[model samples]
Target: MLKDFKAFIMRGNVVDMAVGVVIGASFGGIVKSLVDDVLMPPIGLLLGRVDFSNLYLILREGTAPGPYAALAEAKKAGAVTLNLGLFANTVINFIIVALAIFLVVRAVNRLQAMQKSKEPEAAPSTRECPFCASTISIKAVRCPQCTSALAE
Candidate 1:
């Protein structure tokens, strides 16, 4: 059982999957940062300084008051709110990640196709008979077309 477990852990696919998981987690962090810090800031500026992260609808007033400056403030006050800005940012992040994965998969598929095309084809399984000049199986001991004896 121990040896079997070790073999499963050491398999190429398993190792590759583990590596992919690590990379994917790191990529998620980067995408999150890009959406929140890089993309949203500029977009908000273009839309008259509307901070997306703070865009929310309060269902119930918190302990503090009715009006809250930011989502953090509302949360700190224990307010029940619908976080629309954060959702938008997450949706954008997902789109970017999905597009990136699609491009990577497409490129990999194209490269695999190119490699397959470059590979040499399997050797022919048939040869021409010398006497009759007829196509015959390579293992034939006699010419079937002309009924002639063939040298071994």
Candidate 2:
């Protein structure tokens, strides 16, 4: 059982999956930062200086009866809130990540296509003999099966 477990752990795919998961987690963090710090600010500024971070609706009022300044304040006050801005921000993050992945995949596919194009094309190995009812090499000047002269 231990040996089986060890074999499973040592497999190339398992190791690769683990590495991918770790990298993906870090990549998620970077994307999140990109959405929050870099992208949102410019977008917010473009949209008439609207701050997305603080945009929320209080579903149920907490101890306070009226307007809350931020999402955090509402949360801290035990308010049920709809974080519309956060949801929108997350959607944007998803789009950015998806676009990046699409571009990478497109580039990889292009490279693969280029590699395939670079490979030397193989010559035809077999051809139907006109004189005989048999298949023969395309290079053959004569059909071996029927012993007939073949045309060029």
Which candidate wins on lDDT? 1
> Superposing every Cα of model 1 onto the true structure, what RMSD results?
4.0
TM-score of each: 0.83, 0.76
**Clash pairs, model 1 backbone:** none
| lDDT for position 105 in model 1 | 100
Error of 2 at 33 (Å): 0.7
Question: Stretches of candidate 2 above 4 Å error?
Answer: 123-152
lDDT of each prediction vs. the true structure? 0.95, 0.90
Which one wins on TM-score?
Answer: 1
Residue 140 CA displacement from its true place in model 1, Å:
1.9
The residue-by-residue lDDT of candidate 2 on 122-142, one tens digit each, is 988999988767999889998
- Evaluated against the true structure, the overall lDDT of model 1 is 0.95
